[model samples]
Target: MIKFNQLRKVFDDGTVALDGVTIKVEQGEFVVVLGPSGSGKTTLLRSVNGLVSPTSGNVRVNDVEVCEQSLRMVRRKVGMIFQQFNLVGNLSVINNVLTGSFSTYNKWYSNLYIFSKELRIRALAVLDRVGLLDKAYQRTDELSGGQQQRVGIARALMQQPDVLLADEPIASLDPMIAYNILSLLREISAEDKITVLCSLHQVDFAMHFAQRIVGLSEGKVVMDEPQKDLTAEYIRKIYKTHDKGLFFGPESKPYSDDQLVTWSEYK
Candidate 1:
């Protein structure tokens, strides 16, 4: 449902965030992007939803190119979850989720603090899905970190998106909370048939939750493999080589240069 071909993103400062990357994610598949800091993981995710335009090449979602003309429609079909739960601290939890429907609401009504009965019902249903229905009336700032992120997920679901983009969704939470968040995402992906492209820093989380793993290094794809075919040793090698200090101690493994597979093979 998503495709990137020879995608390259070079900033005005001549910093290349994405370098000749090409990838395709089929409908209903859960793909995890793994890379260290500055590896272009966020750039790749942003490109899909037109948040960041590519310097060269193209990005397509459900056959529609993510250009200026198609951006509004593209965003409607794509949902994003961030590392920091981007919620309005002063707004009620339900109101925050309701904001997702602003794009679809009538302009005159959109500015109003009150939402329609039907929209409120939909937002409540979504909050329930994320186990936050009880907190709907409470201010978002009063909630815990995990609860806030759940609100983020609920807000994204309010869009009823065909594809979900999670940029380090669990980075700030404790490991257990992170597991819960990812498990919820997995359930949503399966039950709704939503294609998910989630970027994560932890290899173990990627292995446990993703059907496929796409490894990136220095803005380039180094490995794309089915989770079943990905060994811990292989993951360690990717970190050891392209990621270096990104992984250390027991997580790092020793491997020779010949063991590293060519990116073209995955292509």
Candidate 2:
């Protein structure tokens, strides 16, 4: 449902975020982009909904090109979750979710932040889907970190998007909270048939939830394979370091709680 062709991005400072990166994802597939910091994961995700304009090459969603002319349509088809939650902290949880439906508003009514009854009902349903129905009337800032991220997810689902792009959505949360968020995302991808492209540095979460894993290093795709086929050597290459002592060899056992704790440092 998504395609990236020879995409390259060079910022004003001459830092290349993506270099000749090409990847394709099928509808309803849950894919994870695994890379250390500065590996272009964020840039790659942003390119999908026109948040980041590529210097060259192209990005297409559901056969529609993502560009200035088609940006509105592409954005309507895409939903984004941010690392920072990106909600209006003072707004009630339901109101925050209602913001996602703004794209569907008419030009005359878009500025009022006034939503239709149908939209409000839909928003309530989305909040319930994220397990926050009881907190819909509560202030967003008063919610816990994981609950706030759930609010973000509810907001994204308000778009009824065909594709969901989560840019390090769990980076700031504790390990258990992060697992809950990932589990919720996986459930949404499976039950809702929404294509999910989540960028993460955590290997265990990706392995547990993703059907496909795409690894990036520097600004290029270093490895793209099914989660079951990914190897420890390729993972090490993706991080570009051995000092973490993350893996011993191809035959190495699964990471223990201590190793998982060490892996958390990458975030």
Candidate 3:
């Protein structure tokens, strides 16, 4: 569903955020990008949706090349979740979700808060899916961190997108809440048949939820393999060598190859 071919991104200051990165994700697949800060994870995700124009090479989604003219269509098929839960704090939860329909709404009508009854109904259903229908009338800032993130997820679902891009969606929450969010994302991906490409700092969460893991280091892909092939020792090595232990928490420990198990086996 998504393809990046020899993609490169260099800022005006000569910072190389992505260096000849290439990867592909099929429809209905859940892939996790594992990387530390400054490893091009965000850049890679942004490029897919045209938020960041590539300095070189191409990005294609669902067989369409991502460019200036195609961005509108591309974005309509893509939904993004931010780490900061990028919502208008004072807006009601329903209103926040309705913003996802901006691409489909008339500009004048959208500016006037004139959403159609159909949109409102759909928004409510999305909230219900995220277990937040009761909170629809509440202001976003009034919700808890996990709830707010759920609101974010519901907002993304408002697009009814075929692909979801989550950039460290659980970074601000507690470990348990983080697990809940990831689990919810996994369930949603399966139920909706939406392709998910999420970036994560935690190796354990990636292993638990992702069918495939792509490890990045120094703005390039260092490893891309199925979860079944991953070893705890290899994961530790990826973080230590690329991120200098920034992503590896205190509880991290290397497991022998014999202890490694595929996600399906774990289940």
The lDDT per prediction is 0.86, 0.89, 0.88
Q: 1 or 2: which has the higher lDDT?
A: 2
What lDDT, from 0 to 1, does candidate 3 have?
Answer: 0.88
Candidate with best lDDT: 2
Cα TM-score of candidate 2:
0.91
| Candidate 1 lDDT tens digits, 95-205 | 899988877777677667678999999999999999999999999999999999999999999889999999999999997899899999999999999999999977667
Model 1 bad stretches (over 4 Å): 232-237, 240-267
Quick one: how many clashes does candidate 3 have?
Answer: 0
TM-score: the better of candidates 2 and 3: 3
Tens-digit per-residue lDDT, 152-214, candidate 2 = 999999989999999999999997999899999999999999999999987777877789999
Which 10 residues in a row give candidate 2 its minimum summed lDDT? 256-265
What pairs collide in candidate 1? none
Give TM-scores for every candidate, taking all chains together and pairing residue i with residue i. 0.90, 0.91, 0.92
Q: Candidate 1 or 3, higher lDDT?
A: 3
